[model samples]
Target chain A: MVAHATPKSNESKPIAALLVAAAVAIVGILIVVPLVSVFYEAFSRGVGGWWAALADDPDTRHAIWLSLTVAPVAVAINTVFGVAAAWLVARFRFPGRSLLISLFDVPFSVSPVVAGLALVLIFGRQGLLGPTLAWLDWKVIFSWPGLVLATTFVTLPLVVRELIPVMEAIGPEEEMAAVSLGASGWQVFTRVTLPNIRWALLHGIVLANARAMGEFGAVYVVSGHIAGATDTMPLRVEKLFQEYRQPASMAVASVLAGLALVTLVAKFVIERRLEAESRDLEAARGLENTRLEATRP
Target chain B: MSIHVRSISKSFGSFQALDDVSLDVAAGTLLALLGPSGSGKTTLLRIIAGLEFPDAGSIEEDGEDITERHARQREVGFVFQHYALFRHMSVFENVAFGLRVRKVPSAEVTTRVEELLRLVRLEGLGGRKPSQLSGGQRQRVALARALAIRPKILLLDEPFGALDAKVRVELRQWLRRLHDEIGMTSVFVTHDQEEAFELADEVVVMNHGKIEQQGTPDEVFDRPSTPFVMDFLGNVNVYHGRVENGRAFWHGIPIDYPAYPHAQSREARVYLRPHELEISPPGAVANRLGTSLAASIVRVTRSGPITRVACRPHGSEQELHVDVPTETARGLQITLEPGTHVAITPRNARVFIPGPEYSI
Candidate 1:
């Protein structure tokens, strides 16, 4: 006979209920409040006011274009350096390795203003290399290149950090096996190591690009906030706030929020792609196993 | 098809993994390098496969020195303990890897790969990946992949070590059959005495980075040249004793063997197999006059079709296990009861002087 069990009193439910209430309250205070406030401030004086600020504002348009354009270029440069650095750090053991790795994190630990100031000292007039650079008629401290240089410095660590752990987890045996099977070094890299590290590389690119777009202090010091040539979104946000163009600034902030949303969506897409690929691989393996089993008996 | 290894050695820091180890394998023979873990069996196999380079030695295949040859150029096949099958490829692709890498014609590759899959009894499972195969099937696929190139030397490092007991036995016999069918020069490394005895034409037993003894299976088992070989090859009973004028006295028991005329009179030990202990009737004149033990049966165990009894000698706690037929043990009715009289005579035993660190 099946036994009927008596239900215990609901003692654990109240603690869970209390945790749910507190969690809702925290989310409301931190996320909902600020988002609603930004909307309320941005759309004040009618929705037309925000629309006019976006469409008619030439400086705002320039800043948006500059930010969008430079971020990708900076990310592309950082990617090359990041991949080389990650591979070197992951695959080799050398003296001062820990120190070299520590240098990658300097941009994260040090202030962005310090990074900007350091670039200025090295590339500005009267700086150490500035005299030689001036003779060559090159502009670095107060140009678009200087802006990219500073932004790239601040965003360099993300991709390298993301790629290192993944690369290290993939041991050298697969590469050695490929080489032993008569594959050239390039063939080994393209066939074996690249496939293993593709997802990590994509994730790193997304993070580095996002950081490059939103870089503030370093770009502000280096860009001179030139309207057509150098002003990025974060700098534009500050410039509008200073010029009493609050609604326009909030509109641009909303654009940044939209970009962040796009990044989050891209991250979701990357994660979903990874899941789908692994699932397909597992299903293929399962199909093969079933075929083998069917033939066995 | 002939392999010549001369004065091969490797040292990692202070540890010498191999020290001037050398051997030869004639064409179309299976050589087994049998040793415990860390005795350089796998290292030697890797060196022959060109996966490893010896510090100061030369390796030759068919009278051509291949010491400086790359792994791919050496044309050697290797089956690892873990198979080392490419996880990303199907079984057909895996078996075809060596040939495809060498840029063979596609039609030839397909024909040769299918033949090997059939040879390893894995014909229709060609499209399946390594992860899809059972342990034994994966091992066979690895063997087929190694053999696809028709290598000069085929090397296996504990090929069946990672399988179930029944699978290991079945696959070992199958491997012997395949080796005979292929008639290729093959060397497989294994520490298992049964595998070495069953699969190899010549067995090389190694210890402490050196070859202890090497011979045919029967020669190594029946006539071990050293105490290490005797103890390692099978279970043995060692007794500290002295041999004087061809008569050895062990544990105050007289053991006379005229064949051991070269033994010194100083302190020595005699190695005797448990099966050599013949249980004659108590107080009966035996072929050899050893002291009779009024011992008590400790435990009894059934191994396969035979019964083994563990007993301790009277007035002493030294224990010995003897294997006997079930009928004999049942006839004797030996149990845990004390003061059970049993007489044992060792028919074939060896005498050796104990080295400084070998005996306790």
Candidate 2:
């Protein structure tokens, strides 16, 4: 007789084992090996040798500094815009509201390199708005502003898209209760809405930050590969690899790779919270739709 | 605080949720907006609580117009149908939220929340999160949080609609007692007529975005001003018949019609509740020829206090429902079983002229 089947009844022992082993083998070859080798090759010439490769090149240090500053600025701008946009679209109904939400997703569909090009068209020396910037004596394209703008454009959809469903699922009943209990609008958001959406907001921020830091296609277009000035970490990695400095390239690439690993871990924890939030949403929706909207015959 | 809603009308796009609905809640009275779904009871309660603005009406508290004021400025306490407790905060923090926002001192906030927690009878469970509590417990926490502000009016939107039946009954009694003690001008929405009758000092019956009637429970029940009110209050058995010459006839069985003294003969309907008719042994109504109808018992069920008997009269396609006391059914000393013949006699039936088309 077969043993009692679990809820996972589709499972078969040999097939499961084979599939798992095949998956592990594929991951080991395609992903695990490459990820491990990045660090292994980084310290191949020893830690001090890797340090000299990084310290010896002021351009690499400056590139590291550029990524550090650009990602935060991009993430900060996205965080505020995302929450505001999500709050606006989620809580209110206006003309063109859904169209606006779709427009926010344009960044995802459009290539990051294409977005960088669009930024160049609008802010570059020979681009539209170039005359206004020139009159104001401000440099945008081939400068820090262009890099920040490109990075911000590439990560725009993360926060708003993440927040809209969660906020809509949570509903406005709690905020209404707070307001009815004598809480101001500002207090309702700060003490109630923000805390409820904190995990989801953090989840979106981590994703945006990861994309902002590791973005190469967009940052490379605007940075101009200027040594010690505009070249970011990803652009610098491309430069070193082009010059045949493989060890130093791996060393700088390792830093971004390590950050990606941290973002993944942070995402793992936040995802657990978000999963619980969705379950709560199911229960809350049941209460709302079944009872609150229940009317007579 | 007494709330007065004056000629309120609201529409959700094409659906008219509330239409010129007006009602008044006396000070310290517990009023219930009772209706079926889409009856606009919840909409009226929300409007009174200042959570919703009417398209063409004003809300007044003791004769002062507060229509344009926001919910926070109105100082009303609202309990949502689903106990919308802050999932992230502890029960203590939720109760202290309104107090903290009002800039109450930290010590007073603690004292007030503790006192209110005791009032709601959740004294020591304040440290637990709302998710950890039972549905009834969460409901009480929502109440405690709402009451922390000492609001002028207390508005509950189907407070027990989401709870299980037993908890609903328990909370109903508890809420009644709470209202008596607080003496606040409180209003609640419910579709259960029994709930409205039992809990409210005055009941406002609504249907299709309009008020059908509003009165004390007995006044509304005993003397329904409209046929809609009568039909909505309880189950009524209908018999298609004709009314003429100060009498209504069902298959030539004459019934008294004192209220309608029309000389003209016209078709009508006789509405009788299950208890309004009497059941007799097979041959007991031989002398009562014109007053009784011959029928066979289809089924008899003793559900709770009443025994329900399903009967099918001869030459009638419609089945009739008859309710008797369980004790009375046992005392009849006759074949109350299925297929057993009996004589059904009407004690008195209310007569109403049929509409353009026949209706049940």
**Per-residue accuracy of model 1 over B1-360 as CA lDDT, tens digit each:** 999889999876678888998888899999999998888888888888777788988999888999998786777777876666666678998888778777899999999999998888998999996767887898898898888888767889888777767888899899898888888999999888889999999999997778888899999998888888898877787776677777787545667657567645677788878776665445642423445444556766788767776666555666776777767666764342334666665567787666774543
Model 2 agreement with the true structure over B1-360: per-residue lDDT tens digits: 988888999998889999998888889999988888899988888888888888998899999999998887888888998888888889999899888889999999999999999999999999998877877888999999988888878989888877777777898999999988987899999888889999999988888899989999999887666566677888888777888878998756888877668888887787777987889886865664668888899999888889899999877878888888888888996958899999898776777785553244
lDDT of each: 0.79, 0.87
State which candidate has the highest TM-score. Answer: 2
Error (Å) of candidate 1 at residue B177 is 2.4
Q: Say which candidate scores most in lDDT.
A: 2
lDDT of 2 at B147: 87
Error of 1 at A127 (Å): 4.7
